[model samples]
Target: MMLAIDFVVVAVIFVAAVGAMSCKNLVSSVLLGGLASLVASYLFLRMGAPDVAMTEAAIGAALTTVIFLVATRRTQEVEE
Candidate 1:
């Protein structure tokens, strides 16, 4: 059961990473990146690293996502 859960989490993380990379829009990429970080935090918690998980959630997911969104908003998109 635990192994299955681990596999699922890892799969989710991988998918999220790919989604982030493949996203054409900056906002979508940032959101996907945040999701990936959130999943990684969950994985850390499951691996018995509560401190690292908390940091990843707070900094990796929340703070970094917000920063990217703000930066994205400040920049203009280029048209092809």
Candidate 2:
């Protein structure tokens, strides 16, 4: 049911966040972060808070990703 789906979303988000943290490539890490944020938004929506979910989707997924990419541009590329 909804709770089961919520659990899956949380698991996926956890994995994505961990992958984002461990990634060597800044661009991929940024994308994973956005993915994690999107999963979080979905979780929020499932929890019956559409307003909060919308904000998280717009700000966490979109704006935060943009900021991370912009910040990445100012930093040195990740070394293997």
Candidate 3:
């Protein structure tokens, strides 16, 4: 059961990473990156690293995402 859960989380992280890379829109990429970070945090928690998980969630997921979104809003989107 735990192994299955780990596999699922790993899969999600890979998907989110791919999605972020393929995204042309900055906002979408930022959101996907945050999703990946959150998933990584969850995995960290499951692996018995609560400190690392909290750091990842607070800095990687939340703070970084907000920063990216703000930066995205300040810039103009270019159409391809």
Candidate 4:
């Protein structure tokens, strides 16, 4: 049962990764990246590393995503 759940989480992560790479919108891509990180945290928790999972969720998914989004927001797009 756990193995099957792990496989599903892995699949979701893979899909989110690919979606993040291929996305045209910066916000959507960032969101997908966050989703992948969040799912990875769940995987870590399932693998018996609660500390690692919490760190991933707090830093990777939340902090990184917020930073990227804020960076993008502060940028000015120039059309040539």
Name the top lDDT candidate: 4
| Clash pairs, model 1 backbone | none
Cα-based lDDT for every prediction: 0.91, 0.90, 0.94, 0.95
Cα TM-score per model: 0.92, 0.86, 0.91, 0.92
Arranged by lDDT with the best first, the candidates are 4, 3, 1, 2
Candidate 4 residue lDDT tens string, 1-80: 98999999999999999999999998999999999999999999999999999999999998999999888877844321
lDDT of 3 at 60: 100
Candidate 4 RMSD to the correct structure: 1.9
The local lDDT score (0 to 100) that residue 64 gets in candidate 2 is 91
Q: Give the best candidate by TM-score.
A: 4
Q: Indicate the worst ten consecutive residues by lDDT in candidate 2.
A: 71-80
The candidate 1 region of ten consecutive residues with least summed lDDT is: 71-80
What TM-score does candidate 4 get on C-alpha atoms? 0.92
Candidate 4 yields a Cα-based lDDT of 0.95
